[model samples]
Target: MTIKLLAIGKTDHTDLQSLIDDYQKRLGFYVKFEFEIIPDLKKTKNLSEDQQKQKEGELILGKLNSTDVMIVLDENGKQLDSVNFSQYLQKHMNSGIKQLVFVIGGPYGFSPEVYQKANGKLSLSKMTFSHQMIRLFMIEQLYRGFTILKNEPYHHR
Candidate 1:
């Protein structure tokens, strides 16, 4: 199964992008991984929060395939520890899905339509994080999960 991460906006911080790139490369050794950035909306200062989310949601939804299982990274979603998250990844792989897509929405979060289309929601933490930072965290967790599955020394258990 291919794991794809779709997030809004580009990472402006070189340090964060470098870390994200490293993890993405590490994850490639275990499974096919794709990280896609949806460009931020233009003239956001003129649009309402709902409108921005609606527009961003359209861009997010457009990137999916019909067979993709999408999961949104939402603040109020289910939170799992490292081991449990590895199990989660294993479960999906066993299910024989084509692509597992996880999305990190814009500042206003996901639109109602986007939420409705999602197969599930997952939260990295109860505390909020910047959208850019979440990209690195998610990628690293994916790498860590794969290491755990492989019984590697990367994850300390």
Candidate 2:
């Protein structure tokens, strides 16, 4: 399956962008991967948290196709170890899906509509992480998962 990571806003830090780029390149060797950045909402200061989430949810949902399997990254979601995450990826690939979409929502998190649309939710850690940094971390974990699947030396037990 083609894997796509959709995140709101562009990463402003050069260091984090470099790391994300590296992992994206490495992931290409294993699977079809795409990173799409949805531009941040404008004048969000005027809107309530719920309103902002609603707007962002519309944008997030707009990117998806009916057949795409949507997965949202949320703080309260299920956390998996590296091995199990690899197995998770394998499970999706074996399911014959055309695209598997993983989304990192805005500052206030996903709206109820977005959450409802997702096939599943995953959490990287219990501790909070910045939206920009999470992109790098997520890509690295994806790279690691693929390496584990390929019996490559990138991940060590």
TM-scores of all models?
0.98, 0.98
Error of 1 at 62 (Å): 0.5
Q: On residues 1-157, what C-alpha lDDT tens digit does candidate 1 reach at each position?
A: 9999999999999999999999999999999999999998989989999999999999999999999999999999999999999999999999999999999999999999999999999999999899999999999999999999999998984
Off by over 4 Å in 1: none
Candidate 2 per-residue C-alpha lDDT over 47-155 given as tens digits, one digit per residue, 9 for 90 to 100 = 9999999999999999999999999999999999998999999999999999999999999999999999999999999999999999998999999999999999889
Q: Which pairs in model 1 have colliding backbones?
A: none
Error of 2 at 95 (Å): 0.4
Candidate 1 lDDT for residue 81 = 98
- TM-score of decoy 1: 0.98
